[model samples]
Target: MREEHVQDELGRLLAPGRVDATAALELLIRQALAMGASDLTIEPRADRFEATVRRDGVIVPLAEGPRDALPNVVNRVKVLAGLLTYRHDLPQEGRIPADSFGADLDFRAAIYPTSYGDRVAIRIFNPSHKDYELPDLGLDDETRDRLSAAVSRPEGVVLLTGPAGSGKTTTIYALLRHMLRMDAERRARRNIITIEDPVETLLNGVTHTTINEAAGLDFARALRSLLRQDPNVLVVGEIRDHETARAAMAAGLSGHLVISTIHAGSACGVFSRLLEMGIEPYQITGAVTAVLAQRLPRRLCAACGGRGCDSCRSTGFDGRLLLAEFASMSSDLAEGIRAHMRLQDLQAIALRQGMVPLARQGQRAVEASLTTEQEVRRVLADA
Candidate 1:
């Protein structure tokens, strides 16, 4: 749809005192997705309400509606998320599934009290997409082969590390699917379970549990409980603290294949993070199979042809491509780690053993025009 048409539709739907505010909000979400937005933010100011959508790593304002209509829109979202509309002092979070856009979408909704009114933000996740395959993530042939081999291990920890929004969870989901597809008999016998904060993506043949700190259900507590369930493959959404890291590492040692994500700059940096988390060196050496780090570089939009266009918001970039680096642990590397070798020395050995560094992978993406040098510099510099 044209931008003007979208604007007009929004204006009509958001007309003051409109009882169809829920329908208008749903239309707004569809329009945001059509504009290639990954996140939608609605802010209520003193005079009016402003809405913005995140596209290509940048936030662009979409529309502004009357302050009177803001409550109806926010309440509609609150009702959908099962949050209390009457309460305004405390923040609340909830989620609901919407298929109004002709796709299965899981929308996470949160509301926060403000000086003017309440603010609402919604994150959209599409669960029916099949683009989470290994080959689909922008991994080179050698790195892909090594990663596949790493996950094939019957019992070890495969950690995907990167900053936020770097596609770590998506990659982990892809790895899980890859493991299930490689063998039918194993899939039939093995039980796969995941403990995630929000359970972003849904997968068949896997049991997913969400984190509930309010009810005393957390990652560490759940890991200890799930250990008795005989889960062949365990997935921890993230290793954030000492307790969770210890539990995840212990699970790997006890003969379960553990897949998890951590926040780190490179594959080589994962060990330092684990050590900083107060985990023993030997525990990491024995159970770690591989560390894969990834980033999402904005791909040039086909509709723009690398030039400014309405479809791409004149940024020349639309979607993102995966740029990844991985280091698979070898016996020699593990031995050196056990011996308390210097991180640089261990990283050198990993590089010699076909491990690709993030810089190298990102450079390859730049050379292939999958992304630009400026973008690479920005991401690596941040790392």
Candidate 2:
């Protein structure tokens, strides 16, 4: 459809009187996919309902409709997701299969009760998207090689650390796919199992499981059970709690190559985060292989020379590129962890051992004209 036609249709669907919620939602989803959005949020306001799509770590407004149309639209989404629409007093989450939308995409729907009304956020996943390969992740040669070496190990934990929406999950998935290809090339068959909250992608040779807290199945419990399944490689979605962290370490030490993601500010911060989780220092030194921290900075718009343009939504940026720092465990770094060294001391050790910092990578990107200094500063301000 043409741009003008799309705008007219959206206007009609969101008009004041009598709205077709189903058609309105379909348009929003189509628009989100077209914009390469990671999430679509429909929020309730006092006088109107607004829809926004998150594209490349930035949220942009998509549309707005009369407040009276929101409930019907929310109900339509709940029905599609197989959620309990009648219960608006509590939060609920469910999945909408790709086939339902006639697209190669997966939608995860989450609804929470708000003072104004129920707020809905839908995460869009394209299972067939192949842009997440290690070569295509925009990593420098040194960082990529270090990550490849770490994941090539037969036994150890490879952890990806970063804040939310920093592409940690994408990097981990790429690593897993690379491992699978390597195993195939070597004529080696390995059993790989993954425990994820929603099991985003469907890999052909991997066993994927999702966390079902309602069924008493969480990450910790699931990891403990999967250990007995004779998996050569285990992928825990995220190490959030003490039990899960310890379980992952045990799995790593027990000859299984464990891969996981954790929330940390930087590569060296992973150790401090694990220590704070109550994981023993010995386990940290023994089971961990490497920690790769990364961030997504918007790529400068080449077409407009960083000027506002229609191609870049007038944002002076087209998409995002990965900026990463990989910290491979060395004897000195291991000893520092064992000795309960301060975070700065450990970071210093990592730097001395040839580990690059995220700030330096950002500076490199800026110098290379891949991104703006302002963009890099905005992303790594906390790091």
Candidate 3:
């Protein structure tokens, strides 16, 4: 259909109420497709619905529309996603396709029923766009080289640690892509598997596993089962428990380059985190290889030429940069965590052992002033 016809159809499908259309939504969709968007949000209020698209570690508002008109928009989305009825009281998932800028777009839509009406969120995953390069993640040469080396190891553990909103998953995925393409001659036959409660990235080659919280498909059980299958490389989505920790340590020791992630601010913190989960100290020092802790910092968009403009919405930052904390096993931090030392003490010793702290990485962001002191302060705050 023509562009005007598509917009007309969408307008007609919407319920009768205040209608507001801006170029923002179009830009939002374009930006997300070009980069990668984890989720999309529509905030409904008394007067209007504010649409925000999260990209590059920041939330940018796309447009504002009449509140009464939102339900109609929600209805349209529901219909397009093939939902019989849409409820604003529970979580719902749906899929839809839309045409934009000459290309057909595929979107995975989810709606969560909220007090202020149904909040609509969408995660757009495109299978057709097969070309993904690790360097596209916007890593500098230094960080890129370090990350490449860490994941290329034959038999060791590399952990990506960060809080929930951090860029942990993105970093891990980059490393996984590296592994998927590491071999030059393409002669190596390797199996890459991931265990996630809800797998995010739709990778083609890797065998994806989902955990059944009730039926015992949890990480630990899954990891044990995975080992028996003799996976050449394994990825445990997150090390959330002692069993999973033990299993991952075992995977590392068995000469499989097990790449995993954790919910910690620093890489070295993984050792103490494992111990806190009840894994033995000796297991950590022997089996673990390196830890990668990271965060997503709001990045300045090169589009507006990094200058303040109405186009960029004046926040100056339009994208995100990855801030990482990599902890390699050292004679110091490894020995400290094994002895049940405080993370602070372990970090102090690890610093001397060449451990890279998040603060140090944050400082680089600060030096570029790509990030502010407040941003760094909030991120560096004690857990």
Alpha carbon lDDT of each predicted model: 0.82, 0.88, 0.69
Deviating ranges (above 4 Å) for candidate 1: 16-20, 99-103, 185-188, 310-313, 331-346
The residue pairs in collision within model 3 are: 56-320, 88-113, 159-292, 299-319
Report the alpha-carbon TM-score of model 1 versus the true structure: 0.90
- Please provide the root mean square deviation of candidate 2 (C-alpha atoms, Å): 1.6
User: Which segments of model 2 are wrong by more than 4 Å?
Assistant: 1-8, 128-131
**Residue range with the least summed lDDT across 10 consecutive positions in model 2:** 1-10
| CA RMSD of all predictions | 2.5, 1.6, 5.0
Candidate 1 shows a clash count of 0
Best by TM-score: 2
Per-residue lDDT value at 220 in model 2: 96
lDDT comparing candidate 3 with the true structure: 0.69
User: lDDT winner among the candidates?
Assistant: 2
Better by TM-score, candidate 3 or 1: 1
Task: Kindly list the per-residue Cα lDDT of model 2 for residues 280-324, writing each as its tens digit.
Answer: 999999999999989999999888968978888778998888888
* lDDT (Cα, tens digit) per residue for candidate 1, span 1-383: 66567667778887765647877787778878887676788999998888888765567878887788888989888888889989989999988656644667778888999999999888877664434788887787888898898878779899998777777877888887887787675645568899998988777778988889889988999998999998988999999889999999999998999999988777878887888888898899988888988877788778876686977777888788777878887888877776777778878888899777778877887787777888787667645
Candidate 3 per-residue lDDT, tens place, 1-383, comes to 32234335445433354343333344445655554555568777767676676655556555555567677667666766776454666776666755532446567677877677887787665444323467876666766777788777777777878887675666667677777777634668578888875666667678888888767688989999988887878888888877888889888988887888777657667777788888888878887877767776666556664566654556666656666665678777666876899888887887776656778877888788676656676667753
